[model samples]
Target: MFHFRRSTAVACLALAPLVAQAQINVDSISQDALVSTPESVDCTLTDGSTATCLEITVKYVPENLEVGPFCPAMIDDIGGIWDWDGDEAGLYRIDAAFLTMLDEMGYHFYDEDGTVHVFDIRVEGPTDDNECISGSFDEAVEMTMLIPTTPVMADAPVSLGTVAKVGVSLSGVPVFADAPSALDTGHMPALDVCAGHVDPGGWYHYHGTATDLDTVYDHAGVEGSCANAIQDAKVQFGYAFDGFAIMGSLEHDGSVPRDLDECGGHVDGDTYHYHASEEFPNLPTCLVGLQAEDNYSTNAAGGIGAEGKGPGGQGGRPDFAAMAEALGVDEQLLARTLEEAGGPQADLAAVAAVLGVDEDALRAALPQRP
Candidate 1:
């Protein structure tokens, strides 16, 4: 597999002068992606300033878009894909050999009869131990996203972390930072050929810019590719939380941009925008502007919040405020610890030790999931 290396010629990320960004015209959104027509409304920025934003509610997948074959039936059969960071550390096909390799290292993904453990965690709920989870689709739930009509550049750029919430694609699907780590959660949410999966909330999202995955696939020697990615290298892929446009991996000339900043951003004419890389987690590395408060949300139980920054967890997730109060710890501290521990289903014993509490007590303090 080809290893990724940054060209030193690429400009390091630095604050650039803010250029006026155009408002997202509803026409740009694919008709199939929307559950309802977008609405422009007043909103608050993260900086406590007032701004207008476009409220967009999306459907599960784009019109006629098909994906999957995740979670193989047998150990030897190839199922989906994972951007593995350990044991070889490259894109891998989820076959029996891959599971066996992990199982040998004690991350059992199969039974003695070689039957791979598969679950629709969204329906069955999260587990205490590792299992391969592929979410089921839900049409009843709708996620509403708010992006400032005009982005406000931040005083300083911020790193995009796990599930970084990059922005929405042309198809109206959400584009995220990184998928939950199999290494961290013990559970694996296998991505289909295009490096996308159903979130536990039942919405479809991309962890990487599905466009131009071929570059990464070829580099990593991976066999499959994205199903609905824009093949036009120069075309815009999506928008970032900050409202900057995200381009496909290549320039209009079908050449890689050499001067991208740390956030994958560079000046494009009058506006500053980001570009996708031909690598895993191909979205922007950081946010260059201030986005709307409560930028993402859903009516679904596992949904993010309405006011801002949501619950940031799946359904049956423990309430942060209640758990923190019960644990007698700082809320911010507890939140950061759990995020660091790999999201909501973080290791309880490990978290207990960090908080200096008994594991059983911590578990009891957490809301019991059905």
Candidate 2:
């Protein structure tokens, strides 16, 4: 369902030969990072073919690492970091100056005397105003993912666009495509120093490949670092859904590779794989191959997580049924409208257009902003 051309964010390269590949040893991942034993399961490939896959389940947060400090309580308080797309743009620390700049840009994440505005997108769904998006941690959340034992190059590169599911890092944290832009959505998902943030479902995930943040930070001139030791760019940080290794910005020889294709992928001898960019949100924006259908899901206690949400878009929230009823709109109609507009971060303008309601009224009907 996700096969297509991503807006030319990451350069796409010409196709490489689909060479024979071997299965990654599931044991290479730490046992603590996993919630259950890895199992070989029959799965449907993206090309409507069946293939064997390794199913791995992990906790919402990584085993022992500290997470957050996202969304500052006050402008002066040190929070996390954000890739500012406004004037004076670049990756920056979420400090007083950042909040001040946001306020100037019509994003009022702070008030007089400097208390910063923040809300749990998990409980409150999305807000209509420009504010910092944050959420509480839910210990019950767990994710199960499938990695095709061997990848098959797709008809076209699968775009890992939006906050789409990218892959899981070595630390067990889920990696995601670049965040939904604050410039585009009026919501700033403040990422920690390692370029990660909590999802609306209360699970922590990366907007960038935080495992290699040191390299990305150096390239973007952001003063941030990751907890893991900097690995060689050639070392595979993790595996994409297509079952190919994901590496950093350089080749095994410590030089920038010259053969990267549109998906930032190229053949390095027998292995055809993808590379992460050195820029902000240092991730491969597309996959060179197909991924399995129903590739991942979130679950807690005994119930499933979000129904249709991806790895980055999990922890189902109570829908807008009540809100729709309050506004005298059909519940299913409102739900479908928001889903198409990007639920949890659905653009209100689009919702108003679809529902034939005034944008201001829809905003007023949403859970009042903090």
Compare the candidates by lDDT and give the number of the best one: 1
Which residue pairs collide in model 2, if any? 11-262, 12-261, 12-262, 13-261, 13-262
The whole-model C-alpha lDDT of candidate 1 against the native structure comes to 0.73
Structural similarity to truth (TM-score) of each candidate: 0.87, 0.81
Per-residue accuracy of model 1 over 169-231 as CA lDDT, tens digit each:
887888877765676557787988777887665667887777667777877787876767656
Q: Which stretches of candidate 2 lie over 4 Å from their true place?
A: 1-13, 125-128, 228-234, 300-305, 308-342, 345-347, 351-370
C-alpha lDDT of all candidate models, in order: 0.73, 0.72
lDDT of 2 by residue, 281-306 (tens): 77887887778888878763211235
Judge candidate 1 at residue 69 and give its lDDT: 76
